[model samples]
Target: MEELWGRRVLLTKQFSAVLDAYQTFPAMIDQGAYMRCTRCNTELLKTAILLPSGFYYCPSCIQMGRIDSSLQLIHQAEPANQTREVFLDWQGTLTPAQEEISIALCHSLAQKKPHLIHAVTGAGKTEILFEAIYRALKKGGRVALASPRVDVCLELYPRLQEVFPKETIALLYGGNEQKYTYTSLVICTTHQLLHFYHAFDFLIVDEVDSFPFQGDKKLAYAVSQATKEDSCLTYLTATPPQALLKEIQASFIISQLPARFHRRPLPEPEFIWWNHWAAHSKKGTHLGKLYQLIDQLSQKNHVLLFCPSIHLMDCLFQHVQKHFPDLQVEKVHADDDQRKEKVTKMRQHHYQLFLCTTILERGVTFENVSVIILGANHPVFTKATLVQISGRVDRKGAYNFGRVCFLYDEQTVAMKLALKEIKLNNQLARKRGLVDEL
Candidate 1:
């Protein structure tokens, strides 16, 4: 490996095209790694590169890494006293599995090693992120933890504020209305990442395979565009896509948590198919399951029912209200401004049942909550959604006897895939001794 000006000369890894450097030979290697010849895919021992820019290379299909090889003087932004992080770290206790994952992520960030973390539901993945966030802040490096939902940002804001008492932090998202400064750490949606141009030093994307981020190539592009050169990105997800799964299988680092932070087992979802499910109401059978499930649980506990659409959710709420008038039922959706009120009522125990769409699947956690997914076969229901919905129950042991059941006229391809992924992840974790095999 040789350095010209500030750029690195390598044959294997590819740097981004933004680097002005050019090379005549196929990609060259710094350490004998094969740099594929562009014209003929042949291996070349010597390579010529044009520079002034740090570094550049073709990873067969990608452009990545530093532009110049010269010693770099990194300028880190200092946050205001308000944004400055409090010295207190996560006081909430974590499981050994959680701690192991945290230690690995801290190491990865320090070494600039990229990774894909596939932990189980209720794995306390966010708490594991604390050490890495602290490392970045102490180094005065910019950091970002992005999710696809605003609710997640809202919930994470206070937690971040608690950790970084003196440090300033901003929450960004659609209609967020929060002002971001150069030095502030940020929690935001994938869309908000687009507003940043090479800004963050440490980027962590939660729910990497979740919708909008997973479905939209541009959102992924936005996340890449938001990071500074030489930045380290750690992706967090429960259900990684197929390509990522294969990559993790080959070399990517992974950590697994089969149990919630409370060490309670993740509930196994039973598929419920009623005879008149489709005949009476495409969604009615699902509603019936909810009614029955809630009735069973209401004798002692509260319940949450997930729906794929708002129209049907409203229908279920209206239908159940008459018989269960004694039970408080509420409907909440993305467009509903009364969401705070609805959530508050549920938390206050004013509402016994919540009929919601997929919006509630990921961020929110309720105590003693038993969850049921109505209309698992609904066209909008996807594999990620199903898993997230199932994740809602038994978290942190806020409840005992947690149950997550998927109600469907006929199970969709997505649900089956979800079940398969859940079992596969649990099996892998158990095989590695990360979690016990059921």
Candidate 2:
């Protein structure tokens, strides 16, 4: 029955073990001409959705499970658990800038106001969030930190576990094998929030600009529905999207952390002309420049080679393996079955060169890494994405500098914009005296 708390699930025989314990509600609400999905709130015309069996189903959330007119959704009101007297176990200290943002976050939570933290890539956003999270938990309030990317959630879970070791934190995401547990703290992807309704008193959306949360209406709806009426909602992003900016203009309290905790300048990308590189890569010929760059960078730092597409990345990965057999290199994309293991291997310095798609552009960090994009002009490489990919380098305080190269046939607007943004951030850090002279 604890597993049923705060969750809205379809009334299936699988849940018969707890079905009698909670009241059930209709899965779809009918309005004369249309029916709305109780989970996703997607509306469909009754005439367009009528089934031969006289049952209307919500196709919008069918991936979760078929919620048809015949089914019911059951949930238990979120209960305030008896929290430990002290939950935070971290011994690290926040920088002055981070401490200021942390205070602002706590104030927002106390006021139950929506807030946004527009911080730079390595600005210690998580550290800034700790105080607020602790305050909420101390009050026995349910808290959830959601992101759009599964990689981000995976990266954040262990860190949260380390900081709040005494608390039972549930990590939820699609394809996750971990069984659900009722707890005060939850780290999950935005999609998982669809299973919850008014569950959180303190909710945060990290990497708010990253897809599929960005420009995703259903995900936004889920975030809204998951929070209690008087709950505090916070958004954290290095790159602020137009939607967030507009919200700040309207009412949200905004905190801007322009410099990283390391107090170092952001690395600007160096554009190198590699004409006809794609054809050469596909044919496995005339890659001397690319080979030379990888060889030199790999000598001192790990190499992150970003390809524009999976097909191209796979082709290049084979070529790289053939050319540098002794160098431990691995390729990962969205659908790689061994993605998690491969990334872990890279983190342990087992892999010298990692070839990947933009799936790794944000949320994960690597120290002393040099970034090289195969096709900087590709449509898929947006300015925000390029910034995030470049940010993966030199993230730790020990390694405060690294290289970023944009290898392209022709530079695109996105490439130019990414460079401009990095430079602008550096200038801001200098103006604010947040970084020392190099």
Candidate 3:
């Protein structure tokens, strides 16, 4: 339009639309007034040149140098429509076998189908995401790849950046910023979706059944509202939830890869009850079986002892450190600011013994990890948590000698279910020849 007040001005539908939105918002910045393009929710930068017609046009999308202030383009240009094939490393780069399955999964997701690939931990699930994302990007669409933990996103982002160098893929987390111009692909924590509204063309939810994301309907609704109704939604996880199973129809696609890189079997976890024995000593306690494991591993390598709480972790740390004074013992948890540095120290072998809560149970990979779950019988241990904890060891190679000790006072329901679930996964992997004869 020629004038903001009134005018015998001519305007195209798009400029009229941009103008319509601009009028509704007050010029005051702190008045809680901001204008976002309804189509993309793209906020016009305040530095943008305001036309006489009072339309704020992003130079990136539209340009009006002079003459009519109605955004009659000096030289009309199309919105960015460049789409390039990109790879996404969900785990890392893929091998020939992994590449095959990745290709299949990509096709399935692009077709708006549901498929399950029960790949083991360290099966390179992150690298496998590349093909799927590439297919969607080449189809001229935006993709949302989300995970329940910021830990997973931290690992998933850099690899995606390497594969999709041309596409803008911003990593979104609670404390992170949106630093890209217009992201065609996004790696984000599930919580970050709360601020989105119809912002993507494809949505991929990783670790779908893991924690916080599964329980929050607002996050789920955020995913739904952040995409067009016809957008493809891809779900990835080692284990599936009851709700996901119920949502399945024939249109869903399923794939399975049950082996690690070296093809060694998933570890066998043993249960030992030292409750009766340890209970006899009111001073402190030790499960003979777990103690034996600690002694054996300490002779050769470091050990990761996981407990249910901070108090339990400290108690174990003290108890273990007393007997092995020559050894270094360190711990990490939510309350510690040195948590990351502690983990780094452990990785560098600064300490031969480490006690940790569930925080270190993921994202970080250890080559020679021997996991011992104290109080495995406690109700705090769930199938998913146990599975994640167990995933820490023997990332590659033959049957790892590390022992997984589930030492408990009693075998609670959580213990039984976690054991059963792990064994079931092993059996599934074994059938696929994912494990050695052992």
The better-scoring model by TM-score among 1 and 2 is 2
Error of 2 at 81 (Å): 7.1
Q: What's the CA RMSD for each of the models?
A: 11.0, 1.8, 10.7
lDDT, candidate 3, 1-438, per-residue tens: 212211111234646555533333221222124444321223555445455557554332222112222323211111233666565433456666588788888776666665655566677776776777677788777778888787678767766787776666678775554543346777888766643544566677887877777766656765665666566677777767667766664556666666776667667678866765334222356445556777887775578888788876766666766767887888878668786578768877787778888876666667676788877766677777777788777775444476677777777776777677778767877776666655
Per-residue lDDT tens digits of candidate 2, residues 58-152?
Answer: 88877676788888898887775465575688899998889988999999999999999999898889989999999999987899999999989
TM-score for each predicted model, relative to the true structure: 0.75, 0.95, 0.74
Q: Can you write out model 1's per-residue Cα lDDT over 100-161, one digit (the tens) per residue?
A: 88888888787776767777777878788888888777776778889988777777788788
Off by over 4 Å in 1: 1-86, 247-252, 276-290, 427-438
The per-residue C-alpha lDDT of model 1 at residue 321 equals: 81
Name the 10 consecutive residues with the lowest summed lDDT in model 3.
Answer: 1-10
Best by lDDT: 2
> What lDDT score belongs to each candidate, Candidate 1 first?
0.67, 0.88, 0.64
Clashing pairs in 2: none
